[model samples]
Target: MKKIILGIILLFNFSLVAQNPILDIHTADFANIENAYYKDIDNFYNQFVGTWIYTDSVKIIRFKFVKKEMFYRQSIKSCYVDYLVGEMQYVENGVEKINSLINLNINHSEIYNYNLYSYGKTNKDWYPKCLECPDTIERLPMSYNEPTNDDAGLEAAFVMHRADENGVEKIKIQYIETIGAYGIKPDGSPSITTNFTIPYGDYILIKEN
Candidate 1:
């Protein structure tokens, strides 16, 4: 009886401390993964971290980004992931309309705790699809949620690109919006209109630091 009890304890401890297979996010299959840690082993998330700004005569916007590591994600199964979380500040016509960047440095317990968050490395293929983006280059995809978009009835996918623009480093974000088949209504009907306040188009941002 004593020996049986000892063996059980040993097995349990091993399971708890056992290292899960670590995978690079670029080529990972996000589903059906069990006890695996999706890692940014190459530090791909670093380049996008920090402050990026976009400005025109009328509109000025800034996006602040940071990498949050080893977040527990619940899907069909439980897995650990590394990803980017972001906050935005928007101004148009000299009036500040939105700003959520104040809490960017404070790590939230959940990704959805923020307005924008996503995981995945440079992706070769994505949905709502990238039209002008070349297949040869991979882009980082992120999903955005506005606090007032409780029933916005639209999908906003923003993909990031890094390149040299006129001898300066710039990040290009393509904001692609898509309409879904479902709605917030209990009757299972889509919303008749959208409540999107953000502008739609490509934004060119410069690194602030």
Candidate 2:
């Protein structure tokens, strides 16, 4: 009777451990993954801290980089955002006024991942389908149009590319804007629209002190 009671107790303890083995393993795995993810974010932020400039014959854009506090996973983290405070200066009707603008430092890979996971399609196939279409459709360049209420339509996009010319680290910035007029139809849709992108200027910006 004593041997049987001891055997039953040992078997019960072994079963308890076997039943929840995954819980013990995942606790350690999650800790290591979280540490690596934050480390990568910190390294990426350190690479993008500086001031950049772009100019044209008549206009100029000075982009200043600054770190801002953001809430992530119930904790505060530092991230970079373009703060236009005291950086943008333009003349309007012979009066100079400061512009306030803030933009996120979005990565191209993030955009690609978003489209891939959300739509389950590559960038080439991510588009509206027509009623009558061929079996195989050639991919076209990606374009987006934003809705507006003003008479003069507006479209804007930003492109960033890296450059290493003569050992000087630089980034090429293309900020394109299109302005036009559109006629509305009876169904509250754009009937006839004419648009063209005015050439502002593209610049290769270097890190400034």
Tens-digit lDDT string for candidate 2 (101-124): 233343322222111111111122
Task: Estimate the lDDT of model 2.
Answer: 0.36
What CA RMSD would candidate 1 show? Answer: 5.0
lDDT of 1 by residue, 109-172 (tens): 7778787776575554675455766777667888786655655456677888675578786888
Candidate 2 Cα outliers beyond 4 Å, as residue runs:
1-42, 72-98, 101-153, 178-201
Q: Give the TM-score of candidate 1.
A: 0.78
**Against the hidden reference, what TM-scores do the models get?**
0.78, 0.36
List candidate 1 stretches off by more than 4 Å.
Answer: 1-19, 122-135, 180-193
- Location of the lowest summed lDDT over 10 successive residues in candidate 1: 180-189
Task: Give the alpha-carbon lDDT of every model.
Answer: 0.76, 0.36
TM-score of 2: 0.36
Candidate 1 residue pairs that clash: none
